[model samples]
Structure formats: C-alpha cells, structure tokens
Target: MAMIVQARAADAGAIASLAEEIWREHYTLLLGEDQVTYMLDTIQSEDVIRQAIESGTVYWLVKEDGELIGYVAYDLRESELFLSKYYLKHSFRGRGIGRYLFDELKQVAIENRLPAIELTVNRENTRSIEAYRALGFHVLREHVGDIGGGYVMDDYVMQYVIS
Candidate 1:
C-alpha cells in the first residue's frame, strides 16, 4: 500500500535527490538542461527545502512498500492552499499515484478550512495541465515570472475549488 507521511527537515536531502532525478527525466525536454540545472540549484536544493520546511511548509512523502516514490509540498495561505511542489518518479507515472496525492491535498484543504487549492503549471507542460483539469482544476490566469538566471516560468495559475 502507498501511504502519505509528513516529511521532516531531515528528509530534505532525500527530497532534493528525488527532485533532481524527476526533473532531469521529465522536465529536461520542456525546460532544457540549463534551466533545469538552474532551477534545481536555486529552488530545489537541500538547504532551500530544509528552510521551507522549517518555515512551516508542509511536505508529505509517498511511500510504497517502504520505498519513497514521490513527494508533495504545500503551504496554507489565508484563502487557499498553495501547492509548491508535486512530483513522482518517472516510472511511477500512470499508476493513480497522482490522484492519491491529490486526495490528500483535498483533505488538507478541508482541515485548514481553505476554499481551494492553487498551483502553477508550466504552460508547456500539457500533460500535467490535462491531469489537473481532470482533477477539476481550472486555469485562473497566466503568469510569467523571472526565476533569475535569465529564465522565466511561463505558467498557468490553476485553482481547484473545494466543496
């Protein structure tokens, strides 16, 4: 059985390693090697992840049969849950794991009395956009933010309203 467990600060290094592997395999084509490397070093490094966790970002690890296969990270905003990161191993795709993780997010929203869950998806990442749509998310708006290194994230801000 796959279970979701809260991640601790000590788990930051493991999450960083998984993020590198996942981004290289899945995002290199869309983001190119240079941007992926830059984002990894800046946003997904172990120190950064540890700081985020220490600052109250909630992280959950997806463990299946004692192996860590994926992670979800989010923060509770005044109005909604801000989903910062959601990634699974390439081989773990198409196994309903994404839906499993999403169900957990929904529960978090309910617990926090948040009205919705929001996340930004790269505009070029059609696969993820479609999956989010299937989960009842809608494109709230477009966003293009410079993440330094002369690269920008051109993404669609999406929201899933909870009932």
Candidate 2:
C-alpha cells in the first residue's frame, strides 16, 4: 500500500535527491542533460526545497512499504492550489500512483476551499498531459517564462476546476 506523509525541513535533502534522480531519468530526453542539470541544481536544490517548506509550501513524500518512491508539492494561492511538483520514479509509472496522488490533491483543495488546482507542464510531456486530462484537467493557456540561464519554460498552463 502507498502512503503519503507531510514532509518537514529534514526531508529536503531526500526530496532533492529524488528530484535529481527522477529529473535525470525522465527529463534527459525531453530536456537536454544541461538543462536538467541546471534545473536540478537551482529549482530542486535542497536549500530551495527547505526554504519553500519553511515558507508554507506543502510537500508530501510518497512511500510504499517504507520506501520513498515519489513526492508532490503544492502551494495554496489566494484562490487556487498551485501544484509545483509531481514526480515519481520511472519504474513507478503505469501504476495508479499518479491518480492516487491527484486524489490527495483534490482533498487538500477541498479542505482549503480552493476552487481549482493549477499546474504548468512542459508542452512536450504528452504522457503527463494525458494523465492530467484523465483527471479532468484542461489547458487554460500557454506560457513561456524565462527562468535564468537563458532557458524559458514553454508549458501549457492546466487547471482542474473544483465543483
């Protein structure tokens, strides 16, 4: 059985390590090795993860049989939940883990009275986009934002409206 635990400051290192592993295995082809290295070093660093947790970004570590398998992180904005990260090990894909995690996200949104959950996914990530669509998410718009190092995130802003 899979379980979710709220991550603390102490878990930042674990999260960062998993992020590096997952990003390298999953994103290397979609985004070149250089970009993957840059993203893991900056956005998914232990320091940044720790800071985000301290700043009220909620993170949950997903575990199965006492082994960490993945993680999810989100922030409660004024009117919606911004899902910053949803990553699992490549071997853990094709199971129901993604949907299980998303169900948890829905519960959190309801508890917080958020009307929607939003996330940005790389436009080329067709598998993830299809998964999100299966969970009732729809594309709201396209976004291209510079994230330093001359790299711009070209993504589709997707949203799931809570009813």
Candidate 3:
C-alpha cells in the first residue's frame, strides 16, 4: 500500500525533519561542510519549515504499507506553481515513486487552474534534469539561486505548461 497527502500545519515538525534529512544528503556532494551546516541551520529550522508547511503547499510522507518514505513542498506564484523542494529517503530512490508524486502535484496545479509549473534543479544534477525532461519539463532558463549560505546553486529553471 502507498499513501501520500497534503500535510496540514500540525504535521510541520515531521516535514522539517524530512527536509533536514534530504538536504543533508543532497548538499553534501556540492557544498563544503561548514556551508552545508550553515545551510541546514538556516533553512531547516523549525520556524522556517513550520511557516512553509502551515502556509504553503507541502505534501508529506509518501508511505508504502504505512511506512514513511518521502516529501515535497511547493508554492503558487500567480498562474505558476513553484516547487520549493522535493526529496525521498535515500533508500527510496529509483522506485518510480518520485514520478508518481510529481504527477500528483502536477494534477493539483492544473486542477487549481495554474497555467504553468516551475522548479529549479542543480545544473550538475543530470539524473534529475533527465527525469524532469522526461516529464515534459523544458529548460526555461539557466540560473543560479542563493540558498542562504556562501554556496549558491547553479540550476536550470525548468517549466511545465499545465494548462
């Protein structure tokens, strides 16, 4: 069995924990230790995550047979949906769950009448880039995002037309 849902404010703490876990794994390869620590400290704090989950769109804990597996956070900007972040437990990758999760999110955006969806992914993350491309996301622009550390993410702004 699999379960995934839009988490309410009450689930904020758990969402923060999942974000911390994902960042720890994802940033280790591209950032220095101190920067990674700083990134986590600044971004994964209870205050920030609590606000994001409470006010933004956060889909919590993809579960199989009732076991926790992954999460995603997003925000709507006008007619566009911006993905804040997405992550699965390290062991859960390659199971095609990510695709299913993304599909659901896209439906949510379209059903809500959003015209487009956008997300930024690391330029060096070829695997994710390919996955996004496969899902009909086109590279709208090459860009960089400063994630509040000395480190900045070199990314591609990918867009999917949802209308």
Candidate 4:
C-alpha cells in the first residue's frame, strides 16, 4: 500500500532525487535530454524544492514500504488549487498511485472550499491528458510559454471543477 505524507524540509533532498529520476525516465523521449536536464537542474533542485515548500507550495511524498516513489505539489489560490507537479516512478505508474494522489487532492479542495483544481500538462503527454479526462478534468485552453533556456512549454490548461 502507498501512503502520502506531507513533505518537510528534510525531505527536500529525497524529493529532488526522485524528481530527477522520474523526469529523466518519463520526459527524456518527449522533451529531449537537454530540456530534461535543464528542467531538473533548475526546477527540481533541492534548494528549489525547499524554497517552494517555504513559499507555501504544499508537497506530499508518496511512500510505499518505506521507500519514496513519487510526489505531488500544489498551491491554494483564493478559490482554486493549482497542481504544479505530479510525478511517479516509472515502475510505480499504472498502479493507481496517480489516482490515489488525485483523490487526496480532491479531499483537500473540499476542505478548503476551492471551486476547482487546475494544472497544465505538456501537450504531448497523451497518457496524462487522458488520465485527467478520466478523472473529469476538461481542457480550459492551450498555452505556450517560453521558460527561458530556449525552451517553451507547449501545454494544455486542464481544470477539474468541484461538483
């Protein structure tokens, strides 16, 4: 069984490590090795993860049998919860871990009275887009933004409305 635990400052290193592994395994083919390296170095560094936690982004680490396998991060904004990151180890995918994480997020939304949960998924991430659709998320729009380093995130903004 997998359990989600609130990440603390001490978990920064583990989170960074897991992010690097998962991003490389899952995104290298789609985003290229260079972009993957850039993102992991810039966004998933230990310091960056720590700073995000300190700056009010809530991170939850998924653990099974005492091993860290995945993590999800989100921020509550006024009436919305923004899911900034959701990743699982390659071996842990397709095992309902993602759904378990989403279910937890929904409970958080209900507790906070948020109207919806929103996130942006890379346009080429067909599996994730389909999973979001299965979970009742709808595409709000498509957006492309340059994230510096000569790379742009071409993504679809998806939202799950609370019913």
- Reference-based lDDT, each prediction: 0.95, 0.95, 0.78, 0.94
User: Any residue pairs clashing in model 4, and if so which?
Assistant: none
| Model 2: per-residue Cα lDDT over 63-157, one tens digit each | 99898999999999999999999999988887999999999899999999999999999999998899899999999999999999988899999
Candidate 2 regions with alpha-carbon error over 4 angstroms: none
TM-score of 1: 0.98
Task: Write model 3 residue lDDT over 1-163, tens digit each, in one string.
Answer: 4568767777667767776777778777766568767866777666677777766656566777776677777887887888867778878887888888888888878877998889998888887888889889999999987776467878899999985
Candidate number with the higher TM-score (3 or 4)? 4
Question: What TM-score would each prediction reach against the true structure?
Answer: 0.98, 0.98, 0.87, 0.97
Error of 1 at 34 (Å): 0.3
Per residue, candidate 4 scores C-alpha lDDT tens digits across 108-129 of 9999999999999999999989
Estimate the Cα RMSD of every predicted model relative to the unseen true structure. 0.7, 0.7, 2.0, 0.8
